[model samples]
Target chain A: MNRFAGPDGNIETEIQKSLLNIDGGIMNILSTVIRKTILTVSFVSLLPVITLTVSAQELNALVWCDHADDKLLKPFEEMHNVKVNIKTYEGTGAALSIIEQSAPGDWDVLVVDAPDAPTVAGLGLLEPYDASTLPMSDLFPQLTEAPFNYLDGKRYTIPEKFGYYGVAYNKDKVDPEDMKTAEVMWNPKYKGRVAVYDYYFPTMQLVAISMGISPDNITADDLEEIRKRLLEMKPNIKMVGDIVSVQNALVNGDVDIILNAAEFVVSGLMPTLPSLDWNIFEEGGLMWIQGLSIFKDSKNKDLALEFVKYVVSPEGQSRLATSECYWAMPANSTTQLSDAEREILRWDEQPGYLARSVPSTISRPEIDAKMLDIWTEFLQK
Target chain B: MAKESKSLKPLHIDYTRWAFHPALWFTICFFIFPLAVMLAISFWQRVYGRLSATWDVANYVKFFGSDYLIDSLTNSIEVTVLTTVISILLAYPLAYILAFKVPKRIQGILLLVAVMPFWTAYVVRSYSWLLVISENGILNVFLKGIGLIDQPLEMAYGQGATVLGFVHFFTMLITLTIYANLVQIKSSYWKAAADLGAGPVRIFFRVTLPLSVPGIVVGAFISFVIAIGDYITPQILGGGTDILIPQAIMLQISRAANFPMASVMAVTLMAVVVLVYAISAKHMKMERV
Candidate 1:
């Protein structure tokens, strides 16, 4: 009767058995699908919470390009079991803009030009930290009492890295003797062969130093003279640009000399490009120091302070000194840099260089504006 | 049938009216609001690096008074106009071939090949150009190999290089726009001109060229607007030999946090673009093709 019958010859029984089997198979498939859908939906629903938990452990920093190095930050992240989010800005103005646009507690740390640190502190954006807590003894003595690191007799930021705004040149193309004097900036022989680093402050300061005017002593009246001196070098200046552009000019042989640049511009390239070298002029070098500070409204203040501590440590200093972005002298005197690395940074010459250099300062607002105006004229010339 | 049509008219009108709401909202939220804010900010002042709502036009006064600053505006206009003229000159012939000469079956592929470089990053393309034209770059190396010159040419950096960079990018953009306009022209128009005892050259000059004015004007306007506002191309290739308005604007914002002054420059730039639009409005057939 029924071909689907098992062993018994009952047609109704065989038919019922076959129907049950079909229903069971459909139920199994439905259960599996429902289970998978439920699991997936549950997982997706918890994603935001999971993300919140992970982000809560992150430390946000607004810094210069140097602090973005993975080699400098990875150890700190691994040690603290936290994520570090960095936003690199070109200038103090940009960093301030970022802070102004963000909500309170959004940023945990800041790295600023040392001369601007006090101004930033005056704005009530930074929290004061004890000098005793920092590794002050291990740092160069001159960096410890930096006037810009303090405001109203309280320390607001600590110097993390320091370098000079001087000269970098291709030794093969230029006479090494000519680089020792600031006169090389305006030397007619090198006309259209010099690239000036396009930073108004230190470059103007260098011009002031060449004119035998100290940067700290610069007044509003001195800008015209400084502007004149700056324009005198226009003949020699093939280009004026930022670190990367000036570096490109040098590497491409577009220019033979770079003004307002030192080891920070060419030190990293020296090992591969032995022809490149940097030195300060006899007039004196203008020192540029970058400072680290904690934000006043940081939710993760403790973690932020710990990161500062890690950055100023010897190991961190070494990594930072050889950072991918640029190589410069670390604030900490006792960095663990290799012998070859030390040679590139001119470690042994730091004492003499530091003695000759006065830290670059932020001028009064009027003077700063005047400097920018004159610098613009120099560029447009 | 008339009753049914009348009944559907109100529904159709209602649907069309509601459809524009999203675009209106977007314009208000993104364009009108920010522009209003910028206009307001232009009258403010930066007092010791802090934004002050003094509601004065001193920033504008200062910009107009400074010769160096005014030079930046002039430089921008000069560079942008030169670049736009050069780009249109280069793009038109390429677009004409694509629209009239290339076979319809492979036009799409050919157009893709023509604009393929547009897919790359702008900054990368700029730097690549620098590497090719720099003193010791590829061009010099090749010239040296061929013993064409004893010294490397001073080709990179300056207004010429800046124009070159802009032309390289905008040429492709303009070609696409011109091609679009060219293809939409009825073939019957060209055929009609030929049938009227006109030669190919005469027909092209009288009919095809005249019809392509809308595309050229539209492209030129876009090129003018973008080139004038751009900071990177001029900054990278111009080599600080001169300063453009955008670079001058950036200097204020980046170095001084002088948003009031930056806003002044931006408003001035916007005014120039609007003036250009007014000048070219007759031929800008934006809705066509």
Candidate 2:
């Protein structure tokens, strides 16, 4: 044992010191490696979640079945990587109620008819859309300066589609030449053989126009006169419903003529029922445009603005026009359409002719929200 | 010493007796409490896009004030009375045949046939009736083919159509109820009356008819209650002219967004049903005695 031991007792103490030093060094190196690895993994894991959280802002889009195209939204979603929840309401009243209830933050983008735009913008629910930020030079002059969008030199909504309400008649029952004017609808020659929209707004407005009342200065007395005229023509109406049902009734010969039907409804029925003919009234018809507006309190303001641009863009508007044969006059002037497409879209180039053909009129007083109770009372009675 | 001895003795009590008992308090909390809340809200005013806590009776006042509301209420009562009478008349014979004439093995099959329409969706059954009653439908075609009439009659939107639809849909349940009560009566009672030289009509009036009063009352009560609240058949088949209580309530809620008015109508309906149930229960008990 003495031989195996070190030469001095201090030898054991020196070896112990050496071992402790090596052990401390190894532990320090291992801790440093572990800290770096953990930091690296945590940093990598957080990138996607942080990006997603930032992109998870609220989105609002107004949708109506068979009206709003769903395909145009895909590119916007891919670019922004955010959820675009579209809320589709059935009727005009339901849509108005949605905007009234959830104003500012309720919807990010709204597709409202041109007549409703003034009322909606007047309520301060829509923000002033800065057309200068987008390619405004490419838009049509009429669309850019449309009275519906321009209020006090500030534009609130941009026109996406334009159409007209006209009379669609069954050629088998009604001669095309005989149904050229609005007065034909009121003529007693078609008693119990014609139909009109059930809503009083369109019916009353058309009646007012035929009665020679200026569309701009329609009053309560004017409305009463229109109502009386309508009641007198009640014997002519076989049935009254929306455009689709009216078209079906026309094709089936259940009704000879339908007043206030959209151009698209008549055109769509033309292929199936070859006898159907659509004619614009010479007294003037409603040249309506549906415009898109951004909600005031939208969380996804930038995304919503991008959506509006996409809708008014040549490609987006053209896509809508081609698919549904929608009477969409593209806002973008740069877009070129084929002759067939132009005919189908019903493009009206001459400003004076277009103006005289489809008269731009204010919405009826019956559509005023304050007078809804009165309207319902009259309807129920 | 007595206290020490009582402590030493073991106490025995059965804690398992309540294992099958229902929780009455739980039922009251969930079911009864919500109904009470609805009744309370019915008496209040709705303001500023929300219900106000103010107790205003204007909703009730409006319901009673309008001739429209009064007319709908009267129509509902009239329809209920007519439906009850028709159901009873149709259900009594079918119930009698099922309980007395039919064989034991075949009775189940016959009862199934009676309740077959109930197995199908009510709307689908109602719609089938619509097709049968439409202008160009089978009934008109047959009637015209047989030279009964030159033109198709307008039968779709009227009170007659609505009452017919209700009776077609509800007769099965009435038959089943009457049959159930009829089967429970012992045949020996009728046998005993017949052996005493009583005729068929006499025995029916004396024994079978009196014994079956319970089923008649229950069937009539159920038919009346259902017919009073029904609005869909009336709305679709009765056209725009028929405005029942439920339709008025629905119009107020959906078209007008007037929840207080709808609630008031609902509360009135509930009161009528409760009064009817109370009267029926009293009459049933009196007859039993």
Number of the top candidate by lDDT?
1
Best by DockQ: 1
Candidate 2 lDDT over A197-306, as tens digits, reads 54545556677778887655677666666666766666676555445445545654446788776565676444455676665677876666667788777877888888
Query: How would you encode candidate 2's per-residue C-alpha lDDT over B140-202 as one tens digit per residue?
Result: 788999999897765654567778888886777789878888888887887888899999999
Q: Can you list each candidate's DockQ?
A: 0.62, 0.09
- lDDT tens per residue, model 1, A5-118: 667788777766666589586556767999999999999999867865865598999988888888888999889878899999987877888899999899999999888888
Cα-based lDDT for every prediction = 0.89, 0.68
Local error of candidate 2 at A312, Å? 3.6
The candidate that achieves the highest TM-score relative to the unseen native structure: 1
TM-score of chain A of each: 0.86, 0.71
TM-score of each: 0.85, 0.66
Q: Give the range of the ten consecutive residues with the poorest summed lDDT in model 2 chain A.
A: A369-378
